[model samples]
Target chain A: MDIPTFDDVLAAQDRIGPHVHRTPVLTNGQLGDLAGASLFFKCENFQKVGAFKARGACNAVFSLTDEEAKRGVATHSSGNHGQAIAYAAGRRGIHSTIVMPKTAAKPKFDGVRGYGGEVVTCPPGTRSREEAVAAVLERTGANFIHPFDDAHVIAGQGTCGLELLQDAGHLDAIVAPVGGGGLISGTCLAASGFSPATKVYAAEPEQADDACRSKRAGHIVEDDAPQTIADGLKASLKPLTFHFVANHVSEVLTVSEKEIVDAMRLVWERMKIVIEPSSAVAVAAVLKNRELFAGQRVGIILTGGNVDLDRLPWAG
Target chain B: MDIPTFDDVLAAQDRIGPHVHRTPVLTNGQLGDLAGASLFFKCENFQKVGAFKARGACNAVFSLTDEEAKRGVATHSSGNHGQAIAYAAGRRGIHSTIVMPKTAAKPKFDGVRGYGGEVVTCPPGTRSREEAVAAVLERTGANFIHPFDDAHVIAGQGTCGLELLQDAGHLDAIVAPVGGGGLISGTCLAASGFSPATKVYAAEPEQADDACRSKRAGHIVEDDAPQTIADGLKASLKPLTFHFVANHVSEVLTVSEKEIVDAMRLVWERMKIVIEPSSAVAVAAVLKNRELFAGQRVGIILTGGNVDLDRLPWAG
Candidate 1:
């Protein structure tokens, strides 16, 4: 697998620029007071498909050759990536197929179908999901776009950090939640090219700390069905994401499930924005380790806002 | 009571400009598609104290004479107005007293106390609340700032519409939820000054349709503790607000309780922002009266984002 470079990110920025929102960087003085840091929130919650996944999916879908594009794209995701692929493919006027577990939320399926994607449901399990995607590719001759492992996807996600640097200059550090590591990996490469002195950090859930373990062991680490409230961060780091983490990331901070929920509630109550638990992980890390960021300028990426409103983590 | 004019609005704009946020006007294509009209949402939900009440309260607090300022400010309320008064008074480093019913939520008291305001508890009747405020005023010599009936507050709330017109130019119509009619009344004056061609419409809950009845009857219509999910819209319109509604407002649109909840959920789900039920009343009005606003550009003021997260109307 090829590792994505800053130049690839620049190219991806141009490719996906028109498709994604240059989301605002919001700051709250009250929240700042609590964290004891000047925090700039890169609000990808307001991005296309309500997540940063749109950038990667758009770049991947549009990067295909005309011959390859004619066959369309396929992906297996039960979350934002599925909707992103469908949305991006719709933008290019091409068909996209999303493979998901049959147990995926009704809204997730609706989200994919809303963007004109064909949904293929598989039985629960990673093997079943992969087999379903393989079957779709075999039957439709569509190109497979891995959610995070692909170079194009990482490069595409890098555009978020590039835009963040452009919008909020001279950040002492940048923190992004590490799930499959696509966003944080891209952020690390962006920081390297755009602002070399800006430290890049990843916030991971302590309940599912494979990425943190992988960093310490200097290799890929897998979690066997690790459970956490941050459903998006369940996936462990893959080889491509692990490469960027090993080379560029400064630290992998782990936060408790309670901390994540508390951070999520604070953002909602104070900043008046809906953010998923994955996004709160980064905030939780910053707040939990106030000494590390005290009086410093930090940028925290709010990766997405696609939450089930009826089932918020803080609510009964 | 003196009727506030466009000049007062302009003056209030300058007075409160330094204190309140010139909040962003957000648009979601999906929401526009649903409404069958291009919608520009003036997001006062992001304003200080999480409501446009900050605008009115700040203006009232700052408009006082030096002698009046020394006496400080006082208001009787159990919601956003209480917090707004506290916040505005704190900005000037002056004392503020917020009188509330003993049954008011604990968070409401905390919000006032958070801003260093004294919270005076009164029994649950209007007479008791008024008497409590009277006692506070007699003891502290604090200037009374009526939530909506005051000219400075009306002028202050008008600034929201002025900013809306400046941001979203040439709106065919503007909709605001009518509580005591401060927001919509001010919006009417703003439309008259900034964009005379733009009609102003008020959205009222069906349960608390006093404002709607008042508009039709050409006089004030009071509801005796009318109940709705939109807790912010329970107050009846006063003489000053009635003056603006009778002379300037084009129509008063009422929506069902279920419609407001649906609109609130839709905004949270699609626009990825937190909005209280009062804000949703305006969106619900535009959605329910589709033919009235179809193919037109409409501006809707999202009045606030203060809600009990644990007890969402849609949740069981």
Candidate 2:
């Protein structure tokens, strides 16, 4: 399998530049003081679909050939990626079909539909959702857009890291939350290509530490029904992402669910920006091991801000 | 009594330039679709103390004479102003004393104290808080910094408008939440100075509609114990702010408590930023009177993001 090169990321940036927001880099004196580091937050929460997923999705949809895009795009995601694909497809004036679990939150489905995507719901389970997506793809002949596994997606996510390096200059390290490892893999490539001195770290929830386990075991390790408040980070890394993680990533740090919630609250209070639990995992990793980031310039990727306001984790 | 000239705002900007953030002007497509107009949100919530009050407080602290600052600065505020004063004073390496109502939320007082300000508690009323502030002034020889009525504070707040016009050029109208009217007064001065064609409007919560009533009465009409979810906008407009409002304000629009909450939630969900209820009043005003602002380039001042996270208004 051919891996995406740094040039692909550059191409992705060129493709998605007009579509995605060049999200701002935010800092807080109080948050920095607490973490004992000069922290720069790359706020992808302020992205087009309130997540970094939009970059990859936009790149993929826009890069599609006229004949390929005529049939539309399909993806299976109950979160940001689903909405991202829908949004990107809508921007390209193409149809999008998002396969989601029937048990998924209504708001999640609504988000995809709100972007003008058609939602096809299956029974709750990864297998069921995948099968549903496969059936839809076979029937509609829609191009399958893997949420994090495709080269185009990885290249698109790399644009985020590219922007981070450009805006923040040289950083001691860059941390990103990992689920299927799309963001971290792209970050690794970006750092390797631009700021080779900057180490790339993946932050994962302890309950969903498949990425950590896979890194240690030297292979993809799937988590069996992993449950965490960070609903976005439950998926295990795929072979494409695992290859990048194994080759380039420095380490995968696991944070507890409690720590994720606390870090989310801290960002909301200090930075005064709404971020979902998934984004907080990166910050939690820095806070959990302060010595690693102490006195260093750390760039944390705030992946998304797509939380259900009525069901805040802290309120629970 | 001498009114604050536009040059004072320019001077304040220069003095406070290094201290405060040139907050970003944000726009959301969904929010614009809902309001039936193009909206430019000057996000003061991202300012140094998480509010536009930081500008005024910084100006006030930095502008003080050596002798006046040596004795420290004092103010009576149960919200953002107290915290702003403390933050600004701390930055200047001067002492700050904030007098607050005894019944004020612990978070508000804690915010002031967290910035190293000395806090004095009074009974829960304007008279008691003023007397407490007076007592502090007498004992510490501290220069009392009025939250909104003072010329320096108004000049400081006017910097927000200057920045707004600079960033979101040529707004047809500008809407800001009115409390003690310092922000709106400053906004008026800045708009008049730069973009004179831009009409300035004040948004007031119906629960604390003193500014609207005062405007109609053509005098200062105080609200005795006004109650609203917009805690920062409960104070009545003072003489200095009243003068600016009477002279320059286009109109004062009042929004109900429900509308305020809905608007706040709408911004939180769509914009994905943490903004206080007071800021929502301005957005609500635009939504309530869509005909007045429709098809216009409206600038909405998002005043602050300082809120007790645990005690969110929507949670109630």
Candidate 3:
């Protein structure tokens, strides 16, 4: 298994610069005052494919050989990563096949289709999705673009932190959502490489806090079946991701679903920016642990915004 | 009263450069396909007051004499301009007395108060709001800042256009929401000043299109008791605003409340940005007038995002 370094992320930035948006950094004076922290939100919700997943997806897709690219790419994702792979492949005029759980939101399925990718439905649960994706790989000989756990993917995702540091200049600490830990590992690598003075942290939802548990126990841990409004942050950490997170990250914070919802509402209401629960987890951590970050310039990565409008957590 | 021209708008860029955000020009392929035009949205929904009104209000507040600013500023508005004036004045440690219609959205009133502004609520009518504002002005000797029809306000509003043109370069036409013609007039002056070739237009809801009526009639026109989801655009044209509109604007287009709501929904659904109905009016115009703008870069100013979240049109 390969491990990505700062040089790989630097190369990925050059590769992906023309494709992705350098999303705006939005500041909220009210939220800053209330939380007792000066925050910088690298709004990856505005990134291509409406998430940070685009960075990983694009890197994996574009790194392939001409013959490999011709065969097409395959991935299994419940939501954001599926759409991301679809969007990245489509932009390069390459074919993409996504194996999605049937229980996934209709909007995610639509997003994959909108990006000109083929969708294969599987029954709900990890085993079924894995089986379906495996069957597709055997049948079509398509390259498996793992959502995380891949060195190329992590290096690709690292560009987001590279951008935050590039834009904000100096930061005391960095916080990001911990799903499968691709974003967090990438963030750790980027932060450690560029500025050793900055400490990296992971934010996770309590219901689906496998990453926090894994870090605390100093081993990979899986939830007893994941659950959270932050569907993008529901996945457990993998070996490579766990290695980076355990070594580089300083701490992990947990936020309740109510706190996540309140954070989402505040971003939508006060900042007029749309952010999903996964993104809100980072904000929730900032608001909840204000004492830890008071007067410090904290950089937060907004993970995604591919949410179902009708199923908004705050809505009745 | 002194009049503003393209020259004044150019100068406003130098004046308010440090104060306001040069908000991003946002576009997505999905949103572009729906409107049948190449749309570059100047996201003033991300502005200081959550709208372009912050530009004008800040300009007006800053233009006041030292003695006048010490006495504070007073205005009568039930929407974005009221909040803009309040927020802008608060930055300068200047007091603000905002007279708003009692029927205004609770969020708007709360926003004004949240900015350290004094709020005086009157009955839901022009006469009552005017009387209340006059009382405040007389009592405090505060500087009277008209929401529109003021040279400084219009010049401030023009700054939004200046930032747009700087980022987007040359554009075919610019469409902005019209509420007492403040943003539109400022946009017109800015557009003409920078690129004399770009046409400037105004968008309004059909129910309260006093500017559209005034454009055609060559005089100020009242709404005769207005009704529209675009609460920010309910104001009738004033003499100074009418004069600027008559001389500079290319045309005024009107859309139904349903169209405004539909456009607002698309922006939220596709762009993942929360925009108020007034901002949607400009988008609605581009969607309504596709033939004229197709294959051309149309600049649309998303004027505000101060909509009542509890009473969102989509929720209703």
Best by TM-score: 1
lDDT of each: 0.94, 0.92, 0.87
- Who wins the DockQ comparison? 1
- DockQ, model 2, C-alpha based: 0.86
Best by lDDT: 1
Candidate 2 per-residue lDDT over residues A1-316, each given as its tens digit:
6589889999999999999999998877788898899999999999998999999999899989999999999999888999999999999999999998888899888899989999999998878887898899999999999989999999999999999999997899999999998899899889988989999999999999999999999988999989999988998899999998898888999999999999999999888899999999999999998888889999999999988887888884
lDDT of 3 by residue, A61-116 (tens): 98999899998999998788898899889988989999998887788788999899
Interface RMSD of 2: 0.8
* Segments in model 3 whose C-alpha atoms lie over 4 Å from true places: none
Model 1 chain B: lowest-lDDT 10 consecutive positions: B1-10
Ranking by DockQ: 1, 2, 3
| Every model's DockQ | 0.87, 0.86, 0.66
Summarize candidate 2's per-residue lDDT along B1-316 as a digit string, tens digits.
6689899999999999998999999988888888899999999999988899999999989999988899999998888999999999999999999988888888887889889999999888767877888889899999888898888999999999999999997899999999999999999999989999999999999999999999999999999988899988988988899998898999999999999999999998888899999999999999999899889999999999988788788884
- Candidate 3 lDDT, tens digit per residue, B116-207? 89999999776787788888988999998888889999999998988888888789999998878888888888888888899988899999
Clashes of 2: 0
Q: Kindly report which residue stretches of model 2 are placed more than 4 angstroms away from their true locations once superposed.
A: none
List TM-scores for all candidates, in order. Answer: 0.99, 0.98, 0.96
CAPRI verdict (incorrect, acceptable, medium, high) for model 2: high
Candidate 1 regions off by >4 Å? none
For model 1, report the TM-score of its A chain.
0.99
